[model samples]
Target chain A: MTKRPRYFNLEPIMNPKSIAVIGASDNPDKIGHVILANNVASGFRGAIYPININASGTIMGYTAYKSILDVKEKVDLAVVAVPAEVVPKVVEECGRAGVRGIIVVSGGFSEVGRKDLQDKVTRSGMKYNIPIIGPNCLGVTDSYSKIDTLFLPAAKIDKPVVGGVSFASQSGAVGSSVLDMIDNEGFGLARFISYGNAAVVDEVDILNYLADDEKTKVIVFYIEGVQRGKEFIEAAKRAALKKPIVVSKGGMTDEGAKAAHSHTAALAGSHQAYEAVFKQFGFIMADDIQELLNLSKIFETQPLPKGRRIAILTNGGGTGVLATDALYEHGLQIAEMSKKTVESLRKVMPPIVNVRLPLDMAGDAEKTRFEAALAAFEADPKIDAIIAIALFQTPGADENVAAKLVEYGTKMRKPMVVVSPGGSYTKRQRQIIEKGGVPVYESPGEAAKALAALASYAEYRDSHVKKSR
Target chain B: MALVEYFEAERLLKKYKIRSVESRYVKSAEEAEKFSAGGRIVLKAVSGKALHKSKSGLVVAGISGGEIGKAYSALERRAAKYRPYRILAQKMVHGGIEIIIGGSEDVQFGKMILLGLGGIYVEAFKDFALRVCPINMEEALSMIRQLRSRKIIAPDRASEKMVAELILKAARMYQGGRMKELDLNPIIIHDGTYDAVDIRMIK
Candidate 1:
């Protein structure tokens, strides 16, 4: 049997032991200068080489090389942030210096209809068998490796802590915004790559790399279009079997497709086609960036539900109804409690509370009532997952509710998600629930959606495993 | 791009073991009369370049055997504006749901197969399912179930299998690089049997 050819070996590009920042500027406002400062500040353990033509001495306290060729040491990676016209020559010189990876952070190529210039840089990299990340992009970051190449200043965009979720995006602006959003929300990341104007490496290459990455447990993609559909599907299918992949496609509408074309020269083909592919490959398709983050956080922290039957436990009747509706909308069933379980629930529950699927515990229910309800549901054979909504505003509910949920979430085999929606107190409760190793969402709808993602992944995994057998 | 005439398109479909309604190309009224003796027939003007035959008055359907001569002359006169024209005589098939099976080369993704409810459903709702080429029978059946009009085939497992097989065959043919686009519109299915009534191929 013939072995398949590897299109990308992204280790050197993503986790380089030694890096050279070409076009490194002393000015704080320049993109090159910001990228260099970020690398130094982020505490990269590898050797850093700053290349500049006019500067002679140290830049940001690191020895500067006048040219990449002048550097006698072996350079594993080159960060090119020069003018677009000079990128091709710089890439050719890097190729001669035997660099393994190149990341060009210039914007004048391809996105502005300058294909020739992009092609020149691409050919130079190809001639030396070096993979290029972008012609116009913010570059990459590996939180575990402390490799931060993004041009945005640290004051402007906060770097997330190292975690299990990694992301690959096609647009630099959107990628940076999402990074900031996830950081603000206290979600951590393992790796991030924004390959804008993908002249060489695309999402498929990055996805393949992340699939085998040891630290990453969930892969996220914010893609506008795919250039090579067959390769992408193959890579995504392989990755999805081992871990969950959450994707939010950008151009689902005709108008958005047109906009995506000018943005990255992406041919956003028929939306129906994309939908079909996503369904067939078992990829969790998020409708927006917020949902993408929500799904990612859940996938990273929770186990997949063995089945789709979910039991919703909420203190508020209105929130319970909304949770039921959202669960049904996502094709998850509200578990019909057994007669025995309902009999046990009727003993402790108030008469006003309904002992049905969305087991409303009533607003005045205390912590023990919540624990008893959760214990009854956890013992029931029919329930595969639980979405517990804790309304912190109620007088009877206290911070101990979060602790009870954490106990059940960690002790039980079934996956559990919490919904704590409200003002400052609720936000603080959410953080406590999250810190205890359970995903917490602001809305019942988001909690339901996250559970649905888990159930859908389980179904996909089952179908694929059966096929392989 | 090259156009494949109706007769040629049906020939390709038949070669792939997909059943197509029996059709014969004739240059004269006598040949049309001979081919239409079994039952009512559909007369269409055959030109590689001309599409939308019904809208252009190039198609006359539901013609009995006795009306072959008159229908053939009417179609000939209507197609006078189109060059290198002939007539296709096809047996009028009935009593089956209308479904479309097609394959096209996407710009980003290579070959892909499309399945949807044919006739007005495809034009009005645009409800369709697509998959990359070389799909298996199980994958093809899953695509059919993905359609919004899935209830139409919910109870008929045999019909579902036949539709799935037809899609797979079309996708395999497309992957061979012989054609860029292929359409089998209004494929009639009843009692677990399917017939490709109309075919168009763009090479």
Candidate 2:
């Protein structure tokens, strides 16, 4: 007589009609008070519960309740921010109150090396068919719904509807950084989830759920390890065939490997074996956070690359050479310009500019040269993708020129990634390029990696496409 | 790249019809003398550590009748200098191409059959190719193609069918998983016929 734990859609918490914030406190820094504040700011519609044992009145302007049993209406989601030992009891009470989902924001379960507490939480969820997100987790956010289940400060802009990129992370800090990357780098996100510790709910279940999520067309994950490799691989393969699934695994060194094993008990086997597995499952391996963002932007915007050949359009010799080196290091061939592509470029490019492989145009006064190179590569049938490296050397190096080139590159529908390196003022250039629906990177290595990932996606698409045909 | 003594290695190769250099295990000087008197002979220590008998003063080649006793005492002294060992008297096989055929189990692909140019040059050049076992003629041919210095397969050097057949036989032996490894180095090819000079098998 034991019951199995039931899992449900994330929609209940993500789009709840009513939410009960248990352990709501008077102190602003307290977990309960922060949870209430986030809920209020997030604009959750329906009844709210401020559960407190000895509060004199309301907290955060919400009517206070003595307990979950004191809440009058049916609760769809419950946010638990209580002491470690009392969490299982609170979860049991929430279950009895018919809460559909619970986001446990406490940290003393499996995360603190307490399997006993973890078991209690698990049993409570099983008894009531409740879907618990975490025992030690920074919650989720649905920007469209104005839901900020997390306590982190919100960005000062519209929640981007840039479709198709959802992020999943094992580390909450990395997840926060991803949100900041979205705001700062303009890489759009569809949804974000940080399942810390993953004692009750692990990566496989979340990935399985995301597999059916309509909003998620591309999923980026930062995983230290996986508890179930075969299950994860199967789910990833199924998800990746339809959409790109990119992973940046964090444990390559011995110390990191040991940490990874203790964290999730993942084999974290040979790094090469992991790489081979990624190749077999058709998942792109991102080397860094910037590269990760760049790849996501590409998947959001252009068609997958058709080949590994790349054309570079730059305003400076150093930038062009660096871009070429990165492209080559990632096993991409320098694209040979076609006769028609060269003809188009010859019209706008300065005579002194060499329209060769990198199409390194003249430095400084290279606005025309930059546009000319972009035009050529966009029209070139041989080129699979293009990396446009724009440097902010002088005022004549108009940012608009780079942005327009990006527009044309997007119009061509070939994979084009931009590398814009400068101080804070280059925001306009970056925003324009991104708004034109093209991927951009801050460094040449990031841009090249993005292109490489795009090429991998294209290769996978080609094989599957050909097979289907 | 490690070698097992001649008597032990020949036992494994014979199972695959890859005959070895004609040799006899001799417990005493009488047996060694009888083997040497039969034909052109090469006397060696049979202990595993006594790999290069010539270097260890354990080998006396091309000797006739009464020479076997003197060679045995010299080999015993050299071998006893390090550890105890046995003596093997084998026929001196000359006039052939020295090639190596062996296998080491690969961690990823499981048991792999290895083939390359044999003798001391094998280590010098590090020329080798490996294929996962249960190999047929086609896989055997591919291994030959994977060699770093593949010119060893030239028409003047080796007969195509003979080398291919030998590789396939070795692959089959490994694929069975009954044996752990097989190293038949310096497998001599004479007048278009292949003969294993030495073989090492571990299970």
Candidate 3:
């Protein structure tokens, strides 16, 4: 329990009641048209006011206005998709109109060596006390509020169903791709924000806003660079007390730094410094986009484990060994089953099966055997979490095994996962288990890493609570 | 960039309460011999002009009282190109865990401190961990815990606490914001405390 500060009011940005889409266009090819169409088609319940320079005409079947000032109704947010040069003046006008939030989709700011224009936008935002998302960004998409501002087309990229994970991405490229992937992964997403250039609103504001957001269970960031190091650290540290924060930072190498500079006009800070801040502050670092997805799946669904001890129930013996190694590498321990539990599992399972930490139930173990082993693991107080390496390729392992894992996921209080690797058959079974809310990792190593991340966060939250005391 | 004089670096380290091994400045070989009377001695060349002390063969160790004069002359001839050079002599710290702690400016993050394995291993292994500066004691301990070779320093938990406290104390000098870099390498770890054997700074 850390209380969020009153500063950086960004409530209206994510859940605005009435939104005005500036530069609304009839031409479908224009980005403004795409953004306007996204709002028109989405589940947004708010009034969509299309603002074009003409002021008298209609666009997207909605009444178009010459300017936001001319609109009589109260506008909670304005999405500006005009040219770069006119951005500052448009934002100033939005401020005068009493717009609570503004998302500028127009580019040609600092990313293109146009800091002068970017500074003007920053000044206007400050003058009006209006929080502008970006002069060059994809803006925000809140699934709960149905407020869609990202310029990406709705048909081409399916938006993820509403869930608890909220994201703040500095790069629109990464943001859009992840949005697409999250949909494919079938996990729900609460909000998605792409704050490009970060001229007025930065990563810090996003972190602070999401920290207190009840809908967001986890906050993830895709950062190529950050605007303020100290402020970012302080905000993130405050946020992590409530929920886990996962970070995937690009531009670690010298060459990558240069590319990042040109991409976002950001001074990609020293990698080691950022690395240290994340580690000491209890922020989970994802090595790549895949890992980011892996961590997000677990944090989004599972409860924090009681301890670091994890038990593995695998159909394949080899996968169990690999998972154990991965567990050790991540500073997690293999849970030793209690003597009584092991004895019961030994009697129920085949004679060839080894009743130990991994408790490998040979390749042909049926769904019943899997369930029996899991029951023992769940009953044993020593096992804080469980990983089931249910390879679908085996004869005895079928859809029943996937269903068993899903049933465990639904019924058990402890965190659990499934690691299934194969061709199309295994992939289908994994998707089935995943859709049922049990995270199914492709490899045993991924399963271990996800569990490790959960444990680290649990450890951090416990320590942080103790520290406050 | 020029390296700060050794005495000034030590003085700043002292002003901020960063522990360091006691050493006396010596200008000539005879004075260096007198300082090494008790035990084995470690010698370091101190000069703004001396960019690479070890590469220039300006540092020598394990010199007895009789051998101090000969070692000092050889160092003097080796460092002849560096016209304005001085020497500091201190009794050797014996075999202790060699570690490095540093605080410097990161272009984007402002001030940051790094802790790592020292001596030749630091370059060969690069086993290091760092955090933004003005960190608390808890953060300093966390930094040590993140190290890959933390077991070497964990022979005594009290020793880890000492190094963690040392990091906090040394951070004050860096907080002054004048130093471009402050590197205390080969800080010998003892039971409850440690000795900073080499202090290097660039201002």
The interface root-mean-square deviations, each candidate in sequence, come to: 8.0, 12.3, 8.5
DockQ per candidate, 2 decimals = 0.33, 0.07, 0.43
| Clashes per model (N, Cα, C within 3 A) | 0, 2, 2
Q: Which of 1 and 3 is the better model by lDDT?
A: 3
Residues A1-469 of candidate 2: C-alpha lDDT, one tens digit per residue: 2554333467776667788888888798788887788778767666788887676568778888888988879998888888889988889999898898888878887777788887888888777767787778887776555555676654433455556788888888788877776755555677778877765566777777777888787888888777666566667667777788888877866332432201011122245345545655678888778767777878877787778889887777788889899988876889888888877777777688776878767666555666667777777889988887776655556766766766676687787877888876666777777776776677898888777777877776666556657
lDDT by residue (tens digit), candidate 2, B1-203: 33445555566567777767788778887887777665667777755565444546766777767776777787777778656676677777767667777765433334556677776666677666655455667556655765655666535424767788988877776566365556676788776687776655655
TM-score of chain B of each: 0.92, 0.81, 0.93
What fraction of native interface contacts is shared by candidate 1?
0.31
Ranking by TM-score: 3, 1, 2
lDDT of 3 by residue, A303-382 (tens): 89999899998888889999999889888899888988989998899888878878889989998999999899889999
lDDT of 1: 0.82
Ranking by DockQ: 3, 1, 2
Can you list the residue pairs that collide in candidate 3? Answer: A55-A65, A55-A66
Report the lDDT of model 3 for residue A397.
92
Worst 10 residues of 3 chain A by lDDT: A259-268
Docking class of 2: incorrect
Candidate 2 stretches with Cα past 4 Å from truth are A1-8, A53-58, A70-72, A127-129, A155-163, A255-272, A364-369, A424-428, A464-469, B1-203
Supply candidate 3's per-residue lDDT for A246: 94
How high is the DockQ of candidate 3?
A: 0.43
Worst 10 residues of 2 chain A by lDDT: A259-268
RMSD of each candidate relative to the true structure:
4.2, 8.2, 4.2
What shift in Å separates residue A426 of candidate 2 from its native position after superposition?
3.7
